[model samples]
Target: MQEATADTFIVRIGAVSAGTIAEDGEYPGLWGAWDQDGQFMGRHASREGVAAFLASCFIVDEQDWS
Candidate 1:
């Protein structure tokens, strides 16, 4: 069996709609917040699989009107 270990990855978050950013780039998948170091700090998966994930990370917010 493969040993479980910590791994790092990158995912691009595109334009936000309804508090979620659509997926883009090589992985083309949704991602949540970022850590202090700017590393993505949440679960990532297909757009359809990340809605709840985004909500958990509180990335969803009122639309910016500015």
Candidate 2:
């Protein structure tokens, strides 16, 4: 396991659920949601544009998981 810094940012986007994008200590990329059983549930893009899109749509107070 690894640790995250305050500068690290994670972006999530979806209709029903959200997933992580560019988590701390992990390689820069997109991620998707998983079921309670840890099975993948959906898809998300990891492109630079996708990351920017996620950031643009993000709302801190509504989605803050910190």
Candidate 3:
């Protein structure tokens, strides 16, 4: 058996929305997340998912987004 080790990574949040209004007068928005190296992690339907994924990982730099 091998011992478990944690790998550290930096995460960043991005907007997956097109930022355009639809003909129905509705705007679409989504929470997109990625790693420090600009690697695609996953697409989330809600901002909570993005935050959850980031929290699940061993993040090194928790940059101030707010």
> What are the per-residue Cα lDDT tens digits for candidate 3 across 1-66?
111123212233342321211111122365554544555455555655655665454243444557
**Per-residue lDDT for 65 in model 3?**
58
State the displacement of the C-alpha of residue 28, model 2, in Å, after optimal TM-score superposition. Answer: 17
Best model per lDDT: 1
How well does candidate 3 score on lDDT at residue 32? 51
Per-residue lDDT of 48 in model 3? 57
- Candidate with maximal TM-score: 3
Instruction: Order candidates by TM-score, high to low.
Output: 3, 1, 2
Residue 55 alpha-carbon offset, candidate 2, angstroms: 0.3
TM-score of each: 0.31, 0.25, 0.39
Instruction: Report each candidate's C-alpha RMSD, comma-separated, in the order given.
Output: 11.5, 10.0, 15.6
Q: Candidate 2, residues 1-66: lDDT per residue as tens digits? A: 011234333334444223233322333354443332444334355434434444444444256687
The TM-score obtained by model 3 is: 0.39
Question: Which sections of candidate 1 miss by over 4 Å?
Answer: 1-18, 29-43, 59-66
Order of quality (lDDT)? 1, 3, 2
Model 2 TM-score, 2 decimals? 0.25
User: What 10-residue stretch in candidate 1 is worst by lDDT?
Assistant: 1-10
Count clashes in each candidate, considering only residues at least 3 apart in sequence or on different chains.
Answer: 0, 0, 0
